[model samples]
Target: MVASSSPANIDKSIPSNEYLLEMNIKKVKNILIANRDDRFESLKMIDDIQGLGIDLHFQHEIDQTLDMIYKECSQFYRYYGRDPHEAALCFRLLRQEGHSVQESFFGNILDKEGKFEDNLQNDVKGLVELYEASELGVEGEETLDSVRKFTFNRLIELCSGRESHQEREIMTSLMQPRHKTSRRLTSKRFITMIKIAGQEDEWLQSLLRVAEIDSIMLKSLIQEEMTRTFKWWTELGLEKELLKARNQPLKWYTWSMEILQDPTLSEQRLDLTKTISLIYVIDDIFDVYGELEELAIFTQVIERWDLERLEKLPRYMKVCFEALKMITTEISMKVCKSHGWDPTDSLRKSWASLFKAFLVEAKWFTSGYLPDTEEYMKNGVVSSGVHLVMLHVYFLLGKELTRDKVKLIESNPMLVYY
Candidate 1:
């Protein structure tokens, strides 16, 4: 039997269009004004310029093409303020032709205000005609679709204002995935298998889809059922022995996944609440206790969104982010329902704290010196403490506390296992 392909294999096929555009744009800046004869050679030197899956039969080098495109875009905007089509066209052309311009140029035009402008539409139409003539395949469809969905979702939130907890409950029920046969899989072992299988077959695509769906459904269930139960349980200190066991890396991964996949646990509020709590604990372990190389791998995976990076992550960190993404998405949805709250703010704070902790540990790791345990403790405390304060501020402003309270609990010296 053929083994399934991993995220790393699928990742290798995905184009880094954004990075490519940036490189081309830099080259354009240096060579755009050079003699037109030299321009063709310069353009030819750009790797995958024609293979970018876009049509570009028009003159290879527009004299002052970069400046002219910018000027035309500005004129279109002035004539019809906030038109996205024209701006998108400008970006499309530059990107198609291998220019490294700002994505914001196009992104701003697609913004709510820019989408309404008449001239923008005219420019977009013109550009589309040009693209069709040149046979440039759809270059930005996925990105544009994602952006549009986000914008529309934001607008819906604005119109709906704060939804009642009851309303969220209803929404969660509608979004819940139908339960399938439960697979008793260890996350660590599962990750290893996926990595190995993925190398042999195209497994990453299915894995990504399943993981995303599972995360969303699991987060919803956690928020709906377990939040309050876990909160009270923690407050009562009822699970000292269980909590101790839960603190172990392998055990924590298993329990968390169990809670997410539990058939009986189906409420978004409880699910989200539990997820938040778990995220706090896991974030602490990876951020404060994990080795420097492990943390660095985590950082790179999150920043680059690369499956290869994900594969390189310590098995534990991979499990953590997959879990984190689910919980964070649920919290973000709730925040969107509330209006005006940035659900991601808390997640960002957590990431920043982790980043700081990584840096300090990295210094120690590089120098081959063991950091003073006291100093490491102090650093962890300060970083995590700041994150908690920010989280509290959001909660105070009416954001649901999706994160666990253990983050607020003082550190016990005995718990320091690193």
Candidate 2:
């Protein structure tokens, strides 16, 4: 096949996509196994593989590596405590994986003056790793907060007129800061950089091949998964119902893939993507298609969640409402059967909450009733629809459902930022 132009580089290794995937997986395993005993290097390789964004293909390997490293952390504790770079990588990776590695793990590297040593600033990799790691801090982490500021400014100063590979790495870390960067976007850039750098190391060549093949494998899988949604939407007759609604299934899939990229989360991705497509239709129903009176009836039918009541909805609203009901039930039943938990009530409630928010915005749109920023923001939290999305997702994740967590979701805390 011919490679397309525009940021295109043809990878002709392994002859077929299937062989590339097989060879890449085996190659990645060998690379890790070769450095298995070196905790810092193993973790660094894992980080680079993930940062370069072929992590999905290696979940089992990554998990085993991390688990081993976690055990090794307990056994060979001094290496991390003695080295700033290793300490940052370990602390960041462990904490990111939900281990409670304290922010104070840097204490061993700090001088008596209670500051990170000025000499450490000259250690480009350490400073860059520390800067990237600092992005994982929570609210009120004063030490990490200071470290973030320090490392960020230090890297900026360190980058002036510097053109080394580590310099480029530092600049990349400072600019994108990993947590804010998408895996796909980061992977593309990292892959391109790896290619351009003319890496001569056999290990790096293997890493590059793994990155390329795994990326192709995932792109194919993601495309295949998204095709199912396209078929479902077509058969569901949403396009006929919400005629002017944005009809971009691919866009919705891309957004969902951003968060749920694991191939195993195919169920969640489809469910969430389907929900997003429905919301796109519903949003248009509220914003453009439905009259105020019909919208009120439609919202009430959703609130009641009664099929008979859906009959009372305007004809345009009927298909949308039925589709919503069917998808919601399907999701709930899947949970009920597989997880042995009845989630229909919770799922229904979340839908009701989302529909109510839709109605609120619909009223505002029709009446031209403009609220002040505070009121707009308060309503926007729900109307933004992230909470409802997350509520359904929380259930989809199969976590033990609790009233307290449900109540917290209802409070619209993290979702307010949307």
Number of the top candidate by TM-score?
A: 2
- Over 4 Å off in model 2, which ranges? 1-20, 30-34, 71-78, 164-171, 195-200, 234-237, 240-244, 264-268, 287-294, 307-313, 333-342, 360-382, 394-418
lDDT of 2 by residue, 116-223 (tens): 887787887788778777899888888888888888888789788787865777777888888778878888887777777647866667778877877777777887
What's each prediction's TM-score?
Answer: 0.29, 0.78
Query: Per-residue alpha-carbon lDDT of model 1 for 1-418, expressed as tens digits?
Result: 8766876557656545444444444444344345334422332222112222111211344435544555554433343224343444444445555555443444344447545334333342333322222222245655445434443343334334446743442233223211211233323234444555456532232332333344454456545444555554455332342233244333333344443444342343243344445545554655355676777766666555556877875655665666557656766666567544555655555555555565665666668878677787767664454443335334433434443542342222123322
Candidate 2 backbone collisions, by pair: none
Cα error of candidate 2 at position 65, Å? 3.4
Clashes found in each candidate (C-alpha, N, C closer than 3 A): 32, 0
> Model-by-model lDDT, in order?
0.44, 0.77
Q: After superposition, how far is residue 347 of candidate 2 from its true place, in Å?
A: 2.0
